[model samples]
Target: MTRALLSAALLLLLLPGAPAQVSSQTSFTIVVSNSVTNAGNKTFSTFVSFRGILLGGMRRLQDKDSGFTFKYTEDDNYGPFLESVNGLAGCPNHRTYWELKVKKPDNKVILPDVGIGCYIPSAGDVVILNFNKY
Candidate 1:
């Protein structure tokens, strides 16, 4: 091969765009439950872009899963506050609200300090929407 051709090939190999990798979406599950009682329990399968936020996956679930539905309000201080799931709204008067939890592939559960808008889910993660008091 010509010297110029070889140099061009090496440059192509060094270029970031020359070896484009497809970013596949990640699959995970969301489990909705009533922590105060056994009123509602359901699971939904959904996906999000690699590095996407949890709220994006929840929106995708609502679009694709008929059994899953949720509502949120923008909190100037907290971003997105989960208000309800499956037609059940949290009432401040009753001290009931939705809590965000996550179960990793290793079966360890974590309570994220941030709401859905800020939380990002990993592959095989099980996000729990727990309806609880306080």
Candidate 2:
């Protein structure tokens, strides 16, 4: 009876539905830059939970680093839209906005179709928030 129970337990553990150990958090870097003003790039390290969105990591960074700050507004159709970084707000009259770009571990830069509220950043990703004009 003991042997049978052990075999059943092992089978259960090996099943596809069984939960496996996984890391709860992922670390990445964030680079803040200003194209219009030519301000030097500031790099920050932050982490988020597994499969967490980029906004979560940004929030975590803001809480930890006094040099980093951000603001966003909710859009009815698009979700959260990044409004400002480091007290620099984008103005429609000035045709300026904050652009989001991500550099992967392989050094490939990608402009995510989704906003920060949706983009799930991978480990080792370099997320760039650039101040630019449209």
Candidate 3:
């Protein structure tokens, strides 16, 4: 009985999709858009470690793609506030800011009630950053 139990444990360890064999790398897409619909849009493919923050994935993309760049300011109360994407900066006088939205694998759109620093992106999630006026 002990030999049979040991064989079962070995089989479990060799099977695909076992907890120990799970992948730590996850792939997601980032889309940048303008609410005004005139600035044009861009999409980037990025990946992060399991349960990693969206901001880290964004930084990874920026490092890989020269055309992609972003800037943010730390908020004491709110964490990181997205200030600019590409070369466009949000202007208070213009009443503009960047908005975070996501399209999940289910095709449903969601607005996370949190900042970039707090968002944990899932595999296959399509994160959209839109520059819009308040």
Candidate 4:
């Protein structure tokens, strides 16, 4: 009976139904810039829980920094679409939109294929919200 119990315990340990691993929170930075107007960039510090989306960190930053604010619209197909930041709204008529980019700690910059609601930021990543005309 003891051997059977041990086998059962070992099976449970090797099972795929085990709880998912949890990770600690990670810190990153966010930079807001306007290439269309040449406005200076505003940098803010924020953190995200393990595997948390960028929108969560942005919401946290907005809550902590009075100077930081943002708004988004929910799309039935594409999830949340960023609409405005710091009173500057992206105008479709003007061909202006907020571009999402990320700079890693090693200085490699990349444009994520996903939007803010889906992108999972890593530690020391610099997320850039650039306003530009496309």
Q: In terms of TM-score, which candidate is strongest?
A: 4
Model 3 backbone overlap count:
0
* Residue 72 of model 4, lDDT score: 98
Model 1 spans with C-alpha error above 4 angstroms: 1-22
RMSD to true structure for each model, in Å: 3.8, 4.2, 5.7, 2.9
Q: Native-vs-model 3 lDDT? A: 0.91
The TM-scores of all predictions, comma-separated, are: 0.81, 0.83, 0.81, 0.87
List, residue by residue over 29-119, the lDDT tens digit for candidate 1.
9999998887767988898887789999999889888788999999888798899999989998999999899999999999988889988
lDDT of 4 at 46: 98
Q: Write the per-residue lDDT of candidate 4 for residues 4-76, one digit (tens) a residue.
A: 9999999988988956777789899999999998989999999999989999999999999999999999999
Residue-level lDDT tens digits of model 2 in 1-134? 99999999999889789456567899999999999999999999999889989999999999999999999999999999999999999999999999999999999999999999999999999999999999
Who is ahead in TM-score, 1 or 3? 1
Model 1, 46: alpha-carbon shift in Å? 0.4
Q: How many backbone clashes does candidate 1 have?
A: 0
The clash count for each model shown is: 0, 0, 0, 0
Could you tell me which 10 consecutive residues in candidate 1 have the lowest summed lDDT? 13-22
